[model samples]
Target: MSATICAFILTFSTLCGSRVVSGVLSAPTNVSLTSYNMNLVLRWGPPEGATQDLVYTTEYKTSVTNYNVGCVDIITLECDFTSLSVSMHPPIIEYGTYTGRVRAQLGSASSAWVESEQIILDRDTIIGSPRVSLLSNGAAIYVSIVDPVFVISTLRNTYAFATYSITYWNGSQKEKARHINNTQQNHVILKDLEPWTEYCVQVQINVDRNPNPGQLSETVCESTTSVEEAPWVPLMVTIFFVALAVTLVAVTVVYRKSISHFLCPKDALPQHFKENLLKPPNSTIYLDSHPPVEKWHEVQIIADTRTVEEEGPSGGSKDCLQRTA
Candidate 1:
C-alpha cells in the first residue's frame, strides 16, 4: 500500500513539475518575411504571453552559388539585413531559392527552431514601385518619391538599397537620365531646364546597382514660365517705385521756400529808435527886441565904394547890409 501511494505521489509531482517547465518556454510562431527596395527583413511573433524579455536569433541560407549561411542575434521582433553580406548570386540550383529560420531564447531556456518556405529572387521578385509626385519649383521640377504605401508583409521583408533615376525629355530626340545616389531620399530637384518648353519626367529604380532597371513610373508633363513672362512682375514693380520717388522729390523742390519759412520765421523790424524835438515859443521875443549888448555885437552897414560912385546914371543909391564880427 505504501509503495502504491509513493508511486502515485511521485507521478503527480513529476506531472506538476513538467507543467511548470513548459510554462516557462515555448516556440515562436507566425514567422514571416518581407523584402522591399532590395532590403531583406525577417519577423516573427512570440508564443503567447512572451514580452520584450524574449530574444530571437535568425538564420538564412541560399541555394545558389555558394549556399550562404549566416545568423544574427536580434532583440526586437523584426531584424533587418539590408546590409547582410552573403553570396547573392540567386538560384540555389533552383531559381534563386532562399530560406530563413528563427528561434527564441531566454536565460537557459529556448524555443524550438521554426523554418520558413523557399523563396525566389529575380526580376519578377515582386518589388513594389515607388510612388512619385511632381512640383514646379521656379525653373526646376521638384520630384518627390515615396515607398509603396501598401505592400504585403512577406515581400516587404526583402529589399535592397536603391538609387532613384530621374529621366527627362524636353520634346527633343535625346532623352537624358540622371541618377541620384543618396539612399531613399524622398526629394530631388531637376535643374537646368528650358523655360516655356514642354518637359516629360519619369522616375525608376536601380536596385543594388543592377544593370537592368526596374519598372518606370508614369510620365509627368509640365512647362516652365516663359522668359518674357519672367521679368514682367519685377519690371512693373520697379517702375511704380521709381515714379513714386520722383514725384516725392519734385514736390519737395517746388515748395522749398515755403518749407524753409515755415521751419524758421522772420520778425517785422530789425531795430527801434527814439526822437528829440524843441518846441517854438508863442511870441518871438528875439525877433521884436534888439539884441542884448552883452550877448550881441553889431557890425556897421557898409556899401561898396565903386558901386556908390557908379550909381549916378540910375540916380538910385546902392546900399549893402553887412555884419562884421
Candidate 2:
C-alpha cells in the first residue's frame, strides 16, 4: 500500500512541471505594424527562446466605434488585414485619432495586445488640370477647371473656390493678372505683348480658404506673337537696282565717243582741211654761177633794144670805134 501511494505522487508532480514549460515557450514579443492601407499588417518575434514557429493577429477601432474589429488568424509572424476592406470606409470623420492593436499567437495560445500610435486622415479639394491665360493687356487669364463640378462644388464657398491669379515671367521680371470668380472658360489672350519675346504662366488656386495655400497645380507656358519685318525693304532694293542700271548705260555712251576720237583722228577732222593737208608742194632750183657780161649784152641786144640801138646804131658804132681807136 505504501509503494502505490509514492508512485501516484511522483506522476502528479511531473504533469505539473510539463504544463509550466509549455506556457513559457509559447509567449511573444516585439509586436509591430509593417503596413497600413485599406488593410493592416501585423508582425511579431517568437516568444523568448521559443523552439516552435509562431502566428500573429491584428485589430483596429475608430473614435465612433467602441467594439474592436474581430481578430484574423496569422500563421506567420506577419499578417495582412486588407481583406476587411477598411479603406472603403470613410476616413474617420475626425481629422485624426484612430487606433490599431496586434496579438502574437501559437496554436490555441494568444499574446497580450500591442497597441499602435493614433493617426488621422485630413480632407481637402483635389484640383486637376488648372489652366490659365491672359485675355488682353492687363487682362486676367481665363481659368478652366477640368475636374468635374461636383468635386469642386463642395469648396465653392471655401478658399479653394475663390478667383485665381495668373503669374508669368517676362524676361527679367515677373508679371501677374487676376481672374474673375466662378467663370469656367480657361482661354485668355495677352495683349500689349513685347512684340517678340517669351512668357511663362501659372494659375494660383487658393486652397481651403487659407492665405498660405496647401498645394499647387501643374504650370502651363505660352508666349505672345512675334513682331514682323518692315514691308518696304523689298521695294527699296528694286529701286536701287534700277538706278544702278541707268547710270551704267550713260557711262557706256560717253566712253565710246572718247575711244573714237583717240584711235581715228581723220574721221573726226573737218573735210576741207583734210584734203589740203594731204596735197604735195611744187619743186625749185638755184644756179651756182652767172655767164660773162658779153653773153649778157648779146642777150639784151637781140631783144628789141628800145633806145639808139633800136634805130640803127650808125652813130653809136662810129663813136664806139673812135673810142676804141
Candidate 3:
C-alpha cells in the first residue's frame, strides 16, 4: 500500500513539472546579421503569439570567444554590435568572424536562444562611397577627398593602406574618360586639362588586401578657370573708371554757374525801358493862316502923230523930242 502511494505521488509531481516546462515563452524567429559601411547589426522577429510586453536579450560572440551579453531586457527588435561593449571580451576586430543570438523573456520564464548566421567583418562588410570635391586652378583642377563615415571606426583606421581610384571625363564626352588609379594622396591635382571646360570626377576606395573596391561617389563636375589675363589689365580698367568719375565731378563743381546760366537765360532790358521805346512821341506843331494886302502903281502914256505935212527939215527929231517931253 505504501509503494502504491509513493508511485502515485511521483506521477503527480512529474505531470506538474511537465506542465510548468511547457508553459515557458517561445523563442525568437528569423534571426539575421547585416553589415553596411562597416557597421554590423543583428535583427530578429518576435516569437509566435508574442505580445508587446515581451522583453528580449541579445548576445554576440566571436569564433574563438565565449558568448558575451550585448543587450539586456530590451524591448527593441534589433541590436547594433558595431559599438557594443563587453567586459569579458575585447572590441570587435574588422577581420574576425562574429555570431549573434537572441531570446525572448516574460517575467521569470525565458525562451530558447535563436542563433544568426556567421559573418566575416571585413569581407562581408559593404564599403560606402567616398566624397569628392573639385576646385579650379587656372587650367588644372585640385581634387579633394573625404573618406566615408563608419559606425565605430573610421575607414582609414580600418584600412590603413587603402588608396583612391579616380575617374574623370569631359562633361560632353563621357566615352573619353581618364583614370588615375592607386593614388595615396588625399589632395591631388589633375594637370594639363582644358581651360574653361567642364569636367566630371568620381572617386572610390581601394584596399590592398580586399579584392573589391568601394562604391564610386556621386559624380562631381567643375570647370577649370578661364585663360589667365595680364595682371595689369584689371588695374588699368579700375584706374580709368575712377579717374573718369573724379574728372566729371570736378567739372560739375567748377562750371556750375555757367552751365545754369546757359540753361536758363534772363531778359536783357528792364520793363520800363521796353515800355518807353514802344510809346509814341508827345510834341505837336500846327500851321498858321495869313491875309494878303492890295498895292497899286501909276504909269504915263504919250502918243505922237507923224507930221509929214507939218514938219519940214529938222522937224523929225524936234517934233519927236518935244512931243515925248
lDDT of every model, 2 decimals: 0.60, 0.49, 0.82
TM for every model, in the order presented, reads 0.36, 0.32, 0.57
Q: Report residue 160 deviation for candidate 2 (angstroms).
A: 7.1
Number of the candidate with higher lDDT, 1 or 2 = 1
Question: Using TM-score as the measure, which candidate wins?
Answer: 3
- Identify the runs in model 3 with alpha carbons over 4 angstroms from their true place: 1-26, 86-89, 151-153, 228-325
Residues 100-137 of candidate 1: C-alpha lDDT, one tens digit per residue: 77888776777777776655544324455667776664
Where does candidate 1 stray beyond 4 Å? 1-24, 64-71, 85-95, 123-325
lDDT of 2: 0.49
Each prediction's total of clashing residue pairs, residues at least 3 apart in sequence or on different chains, is: 18, 7, 0
Sequence-dependent TM-score of model 2: 0.32
lDDT per residue (tens digit) for residues 9-108 in model 2: 6675455432233353234567654322113444566655443445556666666765355356656666544345546433333233456676656566
* Model 3 poorest ten-residue lDDT run: 283-292
